[model samples]
Target: MPENPVDPPGLDLARLRAHLDRELPGTVQGPLDAELIEGGRSNLTYVLTDGTGRWVLRRPPLGHVLATAHDMGREHRVMTALGGTGVPVPGTLLLDPGTETLGAPWYLMDFVPGTAHRDAAPLAGLGAPRVHAIGERLVDTLAALHRIDPAAVGLADFGRPDGYLERQLRRWSTQLAASRSRELPGVDRLHGLLAARLPESPVPALVHGDYRLDNVLVDEHDAVAAVLDWEMSTLGDPLTDVGLLVMYTELAGVGGGIIPSAATAPGFPSAGELVARYAGLTGREAADLDWYVAFASFKLAVVAEGIHYRFRQGSTLGAGFERAGEIAPVLAEHGLTTLKER
Candidate 1:
């Protein structure tokens, strides 16, 4: 904690301290100081410390939060459900469902210490073998997540898994419509192609809506410490997660600093290797991966558009938002190309 840490945007330290004392008593040891954790564009995450203990707090973004997005309760609930599973998650502490405390529903969890690598610099330093091992571990973790039965994990009712592909297209389309400020050239064509080429999803599994290298914390030993950001976890088409991973890996070169590209490191496995590894671990066919990748691109385009919309509206709280608008069109065009090639 700094000598006098100023309050970060979207979180009030005094109120948070008061709330914690009342709810969880004996949690805070000293003055509460907080700094918003960067790299998250959807939910606002803050690392708070009482100088003795540290915890992470997650809440909805400042404004323009779309319907069914940035649910603090959902994030907390899912992480809690996956606590004892093979899927590593931060230990959930408490949830404030009401908005009277921080002006939004928020939750607290034990802060796991590790690096969420967003760039390729550090990964490149690890040499090819270590980087390759990290990539393989990422895919293996994802496959492990897809192997978990939602019913056994108390997430059977988390989301409607039936017609997951069609519903995802419609959901993202709605999200795009909500944030449409300017025309994206290939968005319509990409969406239409994805809708037309919906793949037969594998058995419904607990899906980490945004599973990528950056969303997970990697320990010094090059193993995943905890999978953070459960804002989009649900029971749905597991391949959607794989598709998104592949898209992120492929876009590392052209991400233009918009997407996290730790996968771009010299030793990181290629997108093809990730897909093949996932198939082998989960025994799921990657026959229709093309469509899934295309859909992933479309979904990301909408997500970028949504973030761009929030940034334009002055609702975004961190840096790197200005470049978000540029990603949507790029991803839209890429989605179109993927579909065409398929």
Candidate 2:
């Protein structure tokens, strides 16, 4: 593990213990062992454990943030609402919306026990036949998410449906404008093209804001245990979710020589297979997916730019921060290519 310690603020052990005693009662016994579990520039997630009991504490990064963003209570509510819907999410146990409890709004959920593969290196050499099954299951899980009725899940009030694409275009444009780092030339053009080529969405579905391999947890049996990270999730066009899933297909391309064994197996389907399966399951045509693909690319570019800006301010470490600046151009290129094809 890296030696650099993350300065996770507002996580007072004594306060958390008091809250647990008042809220959870008997769920967690013994002393809690909380450690920083991979934090990005945005939120802080800690893996808390006590004997056989484990839970995850998620809260906004220490400091200011957009009003609508990083609301732990909202995240917790969404997770709790989606329980038993076959979406494969961590079980939400307690939610503390007021900052009085943890210095910031936060929630505790059952720490899903599984391997979160961020890269393809470890997955490739595992030599497990269940990898293929897990891959298929991953696709199926996404299909299930896209098929979920946001209204039924109480997320109809989550996000605005009308002008959703327009709002996204403007949001990214604003982020691009506010960016302090070097701006990519293709980004503005991509945004313009996206605005002009917006397509009609059939219906809004529950879209996992970041639907990628790293956000998914796979158990020892190669089963997807949970879909982690719900910060960006909302009711939106299902195609957006599909496009994001496709955009990160290269995750399995990591480690150069070692690819997920499922990619080569006869029975296992590729990323394209997953998209086709989504179409098959939802009975929706895949022709309009290009626009969503472009949208996904553009959206990610905006997010990457935010990290790049923070890195320049000396708030974050690692060469990956500098590398993040490159994502905008690549994503812009992808968006342009998708638009041209359309």
How many clashing pairs per prediction, in order? 0, 0
Candidate 2, 1-342: lDDT as tens digits: 223333344478767888899887887677766776753545678887675777899887654354455778777888888899989899998888888867788898988889866554466666545656666777788888878887887877987777777887787687666764675868888888888888887787777888766678888878889998888877777778787777666333422312222244333456677788878888877667778888888887777777677666765433345566766677778778877876
Q: Candidate 1's error at 117, in angstroms? A: 1.1
Q: CA shift at 168, candidate 2, in angstroms?
A: 1.9
For residue 6, give model 2's deviation from the true position in Å: 11
Candidate 2 displacement at residue 198 in angstroms: 0.2
Error of 1 at 116 (Å): 0.7
Residue pairs whose backbone atoms clash in candidate 1: none
Candidate 2 lDDT for residue 95? 85
Query: lDDT of each model, Cα atoms only?
Result: 0.89, 0.72
The TM-score between candidate 1 and the true structure equals 0.98
- Highest TM-score scorer: 1
Stretches of candidate 2 above 4 Å error? 1-10, 39-41, 127-129, 250-268, 316-319
